[model samples]
Target: ALSMPHGVRMRRIILPQALAIMLPPWGNLLIELLKGTALVSLISVADLMFQTRQINAATYLSAQAFGTALIIYYILARFLITPMMRWAERLVARRLGRA
Candidate 1:
């Protein structure tokens, strides 16, 4: 997208809409990120799920971790995804000459 001109029709029209498509996909990405984190053993990447399991093995804070992750996803969808959707709506409107 950087290769395209800023504020020009090609970039602003195309890029923002495309990026907003990613906005909705972030729900899937968040679920995937957490699940991907769970694959530390196979992927060789140490992550939060492994840490949580280790911590639970030691101190057993299962409920807290589960609640925190839920809240995090909710906040992300609210604050992040909603804004992108709004922007996408405006872009679509502008493209239709509604704005």
Candidate 2:
């Protein structure tokens, strides 16, 4: 058997396992946080939804403004965060020899 330092063992072994277990929920949390940015706009943070609301105010196009923001958020989650999380999960599973 080979001896390994604590950090090395954790990095090479434990983290992968933990990451596999944590990734799904973490991905959900990320998407929720992304959606939560709309709420953040209530505090004057100037996020996407904030700009969407501004567009609505100026153009009086509530449906178009909010719908565009919704589409943007869905695209981000579908194309970006979801894929990234799935890739990470697959990478960790592959490393753990469980893929």
TM-score of every candidate relative to the true structure: 0.47, 0.79
Model 2 scores a C-alpha lDDT of 0.85
**Clashing residue pairs in candidate 1 (N, C-alpha, C atoms within 3 angstroms):** none
Tens digit of lDDT per residue, candidate 2, span 1-99? Answer: 159888998888787788889989999998999888664465576688779888999999999999998998899889988999999888878888997
| Candidate 2 segments whose C-alpha is farther than 4 A from its true place | 1-8, 38-46
lDDT of 2 at 79: 92
- For model 1, the stretches where C-alpha displacement exceeds 4 angstroms are 1-50
Candidate with best lDDT:
2
Tell how far residue 32 is off in model 1, in angstroms: 8.0
What's the CA error at residue 8 for candidate 1, in Å?
A: 17
Which candidate leads the pack in TM-score? 2
Q: Per model, how many backbone clashes are there? A: 0, 0
